[model samples]
Target: MDMMVSSLQQQRAITDQLRREAGIKRIPVSQAVEDIIKYITEHEQEDCLLVGFSSQKVNPFREKSSCAVL
Candidate 1:
C-alpha cells in the first residue's frame, strides 16, 4: 500500500509538471459542472447547441468512450 501511494504521488507530480510545461489550465470538476448546469438552465427555453471534441474518430454505433458532458 505504501508503494502504491508513493507511485501515485510520483505519477501525480509528473503529471503536474507536464501540465505546467504545456501551459495547460486545469478546471475543477465542480466548477465545470456548475457552468454546464447554468448554461443549460439559462437556455432551457430556447434552442441550445453544443459541440463535442474527441481525439479519436467517433463511431455512432459504439458508446462514447468518455462522458457525454465531458
Candidate 2:
C-alpha cells in the first residue's frame, strides 16, 4: 500500500512537471477536486473514471470494485 502511494505520487510529480514545462494553464487543486466531486455527485449512476495515475504493476480497479482511493 505504501509503495502504491509512492508510485502514484511520482506519477503526479512527473505529469505536473510536464504541464509546467509546456506552459499550460493550471487549475487550483481545490477547485479541481471540487469539480470532480460535483461531477460524481451529479452522475452517480453512470460509470466515471478519475484516474490520477495508471500503474502497469498495480492497478487498483477491478470489476464491481467499490474501492475509491481518494
Candidate 3:
C-alpha cells in the first residue's frame, strides 16, 4: 500500500511537469464537453450517456494538485 501510494504520487508529479512543459492549459468545462461529444460521435457503438456523465463529473480542482501517481 505504501509503495502504491508513493508510485501514484510520482506519476502525478510527472504528469504535472509534462502539462507545464507542453503548455497545455487546464481543460475548460466547455472543451471537455465538446471532446466528449466528439468521442461519442466517433464511437457510436459505445455507451455515450455513461461517458458523458463521467466526463461531466471530472473535477478540475482535483487535477490541479500533484500528490502522486500510480
RMSD of each: 14.0, 17.6, 18.6
lDDT of 1 by residue, 15-45 (tens): 9998888897779999999999999888866
* Cand. 3 Cα-lDDT: 0.77
Candidate 2: tens digits of C-alpha lDDT, residues 16-65: 99988899777999999999999988876554364443544454554555
| Residue range 15-59, candidate 3, lDDT tens digits | 999889899667899999999999978887565554443564563
Could you give the candidate ranking by lDDT, starting with the highest? 2, 3, 1
Candidate no. 1 TM-score = 0.36
Please report, in order, the local distance difference test score of every candidate based on alpha carbons. 0.75, 0.78, 0.77
Off by over 4 Å in 2: 1-20, 47-70
lDDT minimum window of 10 residues, candidate 3: 53-62
Query: What TM-score should be assigned to candidate 2?
Result: 0.36
Question: In lDDT terms, which candidate is top?
Answer: 2
* Error of model 1, residue 1, in angstroms: 46
Regions more than 4 Å wrong, model 3: 24-70
